[model samples]
Target: MTPAPLTRAAVADMIDHTLLAPQASPADVDALIVEARKLGVYAICLSPSMLPVRAPGLVVATVAGFPSGKHHSLVKGAEARLAVDQGAAEVDMVIDVGAALAGDFNAVLADIITVREATRDRAVLKVIVESAALTDAAIVGACRAAEQAGADFVKTSTGFHPAGGASAHAVRLMAETVGGRLGVKASGGIRTAEDAAAMIAAGATRLGLSKSAAVLDGFPD
Candidate 1:
C-alpha cells in the first residue's frame, strides 16, 4: 500500500512530549500532562519519579539510565522495572556511550539486554545512543546493538549531552542500520517544525520534544 500522506496530526502522533529537566516538579508534570492531552500527542516522556501520570488518553514514557548511560546494567534494569511498575508504558534507556565509542559492541549489547530482560513486554524499550557523541561507526554499531538486543527504538540523544542532540545524518544512519526492524527517535535540540520534519524524512518514526506546542504549531498542514 502507498504510504499515507504525512499530515499535521500524523506528525503529532509521532511525538513523545518530553519534560526531562532536573527541576521539573509535580505541578509542572501535571501541567505537562494536561497540555499533552489537549495537543493529542503520542506520549508524555518524563523522569521516572514523576511516573503514574494517569493521563487516560496518552501513553506514558520515562527514562531509565537517562542522559548518562554510565549506570551499571543491573541499575539500569532496576530503574526501568521501577518505572514500569509506576505506570510508565515505555522506558528509554541510555546505553554505555563510552563502550560504543570504544567499539565494544558486546558491552553495548549486554547493556540493552539487561534492560530488555527487565522490561520484558511490559513496556516498550528504547535505547538512547547519544549519537552526537559517537562517531559514524559508533552510531551504526550502537543501532545494530539496539536491534540485536530487541530494542523497540534507537534514539539519537539525551538532550543533556554537551555534544548536542539529534541530527539528520545520525537518524538516517540509524534507520539504514535497523532497516525498519527498529524505530528511530530523534530527540534533544529538535525545537522547530522543520527540524522535526527533516528527522522524519530521514527515517525517524518517532520524536522526543519538550517544545511540543511550539513545534506542533509550526508544523505545516
Candidate 2:
C-alpha cells in the first residue's frame, strides 16, 4: 500500500529516539538527549537505570524487565515504578513470550495488567510482544492481551532477541488488531528513513530508533 509520505515534523513527532545498549552510561544518555533535541524527535528511550533524563521537551521512556520478559509480573511492576519514580515518562515492559506461546492468554493479560496498574497512568505503558518470535495467531493474541490489560501501546520487539526485530508484517497485524483503540510501536533494527516510513504505513503510531538522527536526516524537508 502506497501511503502519503509524512512531513518532517510529523515524522519527528512519531519517533522515540532510543539508546538501549547494555553498557550505555550517563554520558551516552546525555549525548542521546542532545541528538534528540537536534533532531526534534518526540522522545528518548533508555534503560530504566538511565531514568530522569531531564531533556526538557522530550518524553523520557524506559524499559522494564528488558529484553527478556521472563521476570515475574510483580518484579516488572516494581521495576516500572522505580523508573517512573526516577522520572521516566513512559515504560516499555516485555511480556512473557513463553506464556503467550503456550496459548495462555490469561497469564499474559494478568502480567501486563500488573505493570499497567503500577504505572497508574503516570506513564504510558507499552507492552513488547517480541513479534519476530511468535506465530500470527500468537501475535494477535498478545496484542489483545495488552489491550485487555489496559496498556497504552503495543510494541513489536526488544531488539536483543536472537530471532530478529520488527517487521512490516508484524506492525500491520498489530494495527489491524488494535485499530484505533491502542497505539502500535514498531521498533528494533529500523535503520533508515524508508524503514521508518514503511512502519508508519503499516499503521504504527510510534517508531523506536537507536539511529534516529540518521533516519531523520534522510527524510525530505
Candidate 3:
C-alpha cells in the first residue's frame, strides 16, 4: 500500500526524535533539542535522568522498565511518576517479556497498570511490547493487555533489544487490534524516509527514530 502524502510539517509532527544511546552526552542532547525544535517533531525521547534538564519546549518522553522489563512493578511505577514530575510528557514503559512468554497475564497487566496509574494525570503512557522478542500471538496479547491497562499507545521495540525492531506484520497486527482506540508507535531501525512512510502506512501514528534528521533530509521540502 502506498503511504498517504505527508507534508514536511505533517511528517515532522509524526516523529519522536530519540536519544537513548549510552554514549549520548549533554551536548548531544542539546543538539537534539535544537533539531527537534527546528523540525517540530512530536517529541524528544530521552533517558529518564535527562528529562529534568532537557528541553521544556519539546514534549519530553522517557522509557520506563527500559529495554529489560525485569524490574519490579513498583519500581516502574515510581520511575514513571518521577519522569512525569521531571517534565516528561510521555512515558514508554516496557512490558515484562518473561511474564508474557510464561502466559502470566496477571503479572503483565499489573505491571502496565501500575505505571499507567502513576502517570494517569501526568503523562501519556505508551506500552513497549518489544515486538522483536515475541511471537505473533504474544504481540497481540500484549497490545490487548496494554489497551486494557489504559495505555495511550502500543510501541514496537526499545531499539536496544538484540532481536531487532519494528516489523510490518507487527504494525499491522497492532493497528487491527487497537483500531482507533489507541495510537501505534513504530520505533527501532527506522532510518530512511521509505521506512518511515512504510510504518505510517501500516497504521503507525508515531515514529520513534534516532536518525530523524537523516530521514527528513532524504525527503524534499
> Model 3: which residue pairs collide?
none
Worst 10 residues of 3 by lDDT: 49-58
TM-scores, all models, native as reference: 0.97, 0.97, 0.95
Count clashing residue pairs per candidate.
0, 0, 0
* Poorly placed runs, candidate 1 (over 4 Å): 1-5
Candidate 3 per-residue lDDT, tens place, 1-221, comes to: 86457766787888899999888888888999998998888899998877686475678899998879999999999999999998898999999998887777778999999998898868999999988889888888898999999999999999989999998789989999899799999999999898888888789999999999888876667
- Kindly indicate the candidate among 2 and 3 with the higher lDDT: 2
Tell me the lDDT of model 3 at 18. Answer: 95
User: Could you tell me the TM-score of candidate 2?
Assistant: 0.97
**Candidate 1: residue pairs that collide:** none
| Whole-model Cα lDDT of every candidate shown, in order | 0.93, 0.93, 0.89
Candidate 1 lDDT, 82-157, residue by residue in tens: 9999899999999999999999999999999999999999999999999999999999999989999999999999
Over 4 Å off, model 2: 1-3
TM-score of 1: 0.97
Kindly indicate the candidate among 1 and 2 with the higher lDDT: 1
Candidate 3 local Cα displacement, residue 191, angstroms: 0.5
Residue ranges of candidate 3 with Cα displaced over 4 Å: 1-4, 54-56
